[model samples]
Target: MSALQLQSAAGLLLLPALAWALGGFRRGVAPRVIATALALQLGLAAALLNIPPLRAAFALIGDGVNALATATKAGTALVFGYLGGAPLPFEEPFPGASFILFFQALPLVLVVGALSAVLYHWGVLPAIVRGMARLLRALLGLGGATGFGVAANVFVGMVEAPLMIRAWLARLTRSELFVVMTAGLATISGNTLVVYALVIAPVVPDAAGQLLTASLVSAPAAILAALLMIPPAPGEAATEGEEGIPTGLYDSSMDALVRGTQDGLGLLLGIMASLIVFVAIVALVNLALEPLTGLTLQKVMGWALWPVAWAMGVPAAEAATVGASLGVKMVVNEFVSYLDLARSGGAGLSDRSRLILTYALCGFTNLGSVGIMVGGMTAMCPERRHDIVRLGLPALVSGTIACCMTGAVVGVLTPP
Candidate 1:
C-alpha cells in the first residue's frame, strides 16, 4: 500500500480504539458490533464514492446544489442590493473584491432552509428518509425508531429529526439514546449544507457531493462510535415508534414556507452573532498570549491536534493546518471552520488533506452542540432528561470520532 493509504488505514483503527478506550461501558462493547459498523461505513463509502455510476449520480446532485446556491443570489440581491452581489452603481476596486459574506453567503441558508421545509411538507423528504431508515435498520441492526431518527437527521435539523420518533424517546435504552445523539452531532442538516458548500466550493472540487456523502456516511459512523462507547445489553432494544415524520410538523406548504423562513432567519442571526463573538474572543486571547508565546490560538490548537490530522493521512508539513481547522470546528463550530478553510482556499495543504478535512469537519461536534442535543432530546421526553444530560458529553466525543472515521475512510479511498 502507498504511504498515505497506510497512514489512513492506521487512522481507521486508531479512531475506534480511542472510542473503545473512552467507552462508558467497556465490558459491553462487542467485537462483532464494532466490526459490523465499520464494515457498513466502508461499504457505503465505497458505493457512494468508488462506484462509477453512483459517483456520477452524486456529481449531478452536486451540480444541482451549486445551481440552487446560485439561485439564492436573485433574492439576496433584491433584498440587499449591490452589497448582496448585484451590479454596483460604482465600480469595484478590483474584480471579485465586492464580496460581503453577511449579505452574499449567509442568505443562502435561509432560502435552502425554507425549501427543505417545503419538501418535508410535501412528504418528499420523509419518503426518502423512510426508505433510507429501513435500509439502515436492516444493515445496522437498529430498531425502527432509531433507524428513522438517524435517517431523518440527514435531511433535517438535529432537533427536528427526533420529533419524528418522539413517541418512543422515553423508552429508548441508554445505548439507543446515545446513538441518536451521536447521529445528530455527526451529521449536518440540508439547509446548512448549502452554506458550507458555498464556502468550500472554491477550494474543493465537487464540494456539494462530498458534503452530501459525508453526511450520509457519517450517520452509520455515528452508530458505530456509539456502539463502541456504550454497547446495548442483551435483549435491550429501542422501542418502536411511529414509522415516519409526524404529519403536524407543518400545517401546509405555505405554513412550511413561513415557519422554515423564520427558523432559517433565526439560524442566520445566530451564526452571525456566533461568528462576531467567537472571532473577537479568539483575537483577544491571541493578543494576550502572542507576545509571551509567539503563537496564536490556532497554532496552539493546531499543535494539540496535530497527531489527529497526521493520523488521517495529512502530510507532515500540512498536518498543523488541518489540525487547526479541526480544533476550530471542535472549539467553536463547523461554520467558522469552513469559513476559515474558504478564506485560506485550502492553501498549504495537499488535495488529500483538503478532502480529509472536508469530511472530518462536516459535523456539529462543537461544545455548543452538546447543550443543543441534550436540550432537544430532553424536551422530547421529559422523563429521560437525566439520561440525556449524562450521555451528552460522551455523545459529543463519540460523534467527533465518528466524523474523523469518515475522513479516514475517504483518505484511504482517495488516490494519492
Candidate 2:
C-alpha cells in the first residue's frame, strides 16, 4: 500500500493512539472487541457504500427521512396554518420568496422529539436501549451506566444521554464520567438526523443511512477510546439495564407530548443561535486575516487539517478541500462542516473522499461542546462538577479521534 494508504489505515486507530498517549492503556484490554469493531466498521462501510443489496436496504432510511420531512410539513401546516407551510391564502407564498429555518428544520426537530417521547412512554424506546446496552456490555466489557449511555446516545442528544442514567452520575468515577462525555459527543442525536439529511439528500442519495451508519460505527470507537484513555476503577459494577430515561419523567401521554415539544423548542433555539454566531465569527476572522496573508478562515482550516484529510486517503490534489471540512467540524461543529461539504458541491471529489467526509463530520466534538457537557452534567449532578471540568478537554479529544477513526475506516477500505 502507498504511504498515505497506510496512514489512512493507521488513522482508523487514531482514537486508540490518542488514548495510549494519554496513559491507562492496558495491553490486553478488550482487544478482541476492539479489533472486531474496527473490522466491522470497515466491512459495514464497504457493504453499505458499495454492495447493491445492503445499499438498497440502507437507502430506505433516506427515503424515510424525505417522507418524515413531508409528514412534518403536514403537522406544521395544521398548527401554524398559512405561515407554517408553502401556499398562502391568495397573494404570496406562506413562507415568502424563500425557505425558512423556523418553518422547515426546527419544526421537523420538534415533531421528531414529540414522536420520540411518545415512543419512550409506550416502552418501545427503553426496549431498544436495553437491547443495545446488553449487546454492548457483553461485547465491550462496559459497566452498566457507560454501556447504556453509549447506546442511548445514538437515539438521543449528547446531554440527554446521561439523563438515561441520572442516578449514577454523581457516583461515577472520572474514567466512567469521561466515557459518558466522550460517547455523547461522539454520536449524533436522532432529532438532528432529519435536519442534516435535508442538507445533503440532494447530493448524496442515501443521506439518512450514511448519517445513521456514522453513529453506529462510532459507538464502539468511542467506547474503546474512552476505555483506553481512562480505565475504569477495579470492581466498578454499574447498575443494570434500568439505566434509562428516569421513571415517572412524564405523568401522562399528553404530558410526554408537551414535554417533548418543550425540549425540542430548547434545541431549536440553541441550534439556530449557534449557527448564526459561529458563521458570523468565521466571517470576522476571515476579514481580519485577509489583510495579512490573504487567507480566509476556510483556507487556513484547509491548510491546517490537510494532513488529516490526506491521511484519510483523499486524493492528493483535493486533500485540502476535504481537510477544510474536518477542521470546521472540529473547530466549529458538524452542522457547519456538512454545509461546507454540501457547498463543495462534490466537484472534483472522488467517491472515497466524499464517503470519508460524510462519516467524519457526524458528531458534536467541538470546543464549545466541552462547556455544554460540563454545564449539563453539573445541573444533573452537582457533586461531580469538579470531575466534569477536569475531563472536558480529554473528552473532546477522544470524541474527535473517534469520528476520525470511522472516516479512516471508510478511506482504508475503499479502493485507491
Maximum-lDDT candidate: 1
Which portions of model 2 miss their true places by more than 4 Å?
A: 1-7, 22-30, 43-54, 75-85, 88-97, 233-245
Q: In model 1, where do residues sit more than 4 Å from their true spots? A: 242-244
lDDT of 1 by residue, 1-416 (tens): 68998999899989888888888447665577678877877788889887899879877877877787678888888989999879899978986689988999889888888898899889898889889888877777788888899998887777888777898888788888888889999999988888888788889888888898999889988998888888888767555663645887888889999999999998889778877877788889889999998998888889998988888887888888999999888778899999888888888888888999999999999877777778778888999999999998888899999999999889888877
lDDT per residue, candidate 2, 1-61, as tens digits? Answer: 7665676887766647767677655553556867776766776677777788877877688
TM-score of structure candidate 2: 0.89
| Every model's TM-score | 0.95, 0.89
Instruction: State the lDDT at 264 in candidate 2.
Output: 89
Worst 10 residues of 2 by lDDT: 92-101
Q: If candidate 1 were superposed on the true structure by all CA atoms, what would the RMSD be?
A: 1.8
lDDT score of residue 28 within candidate 1: 69
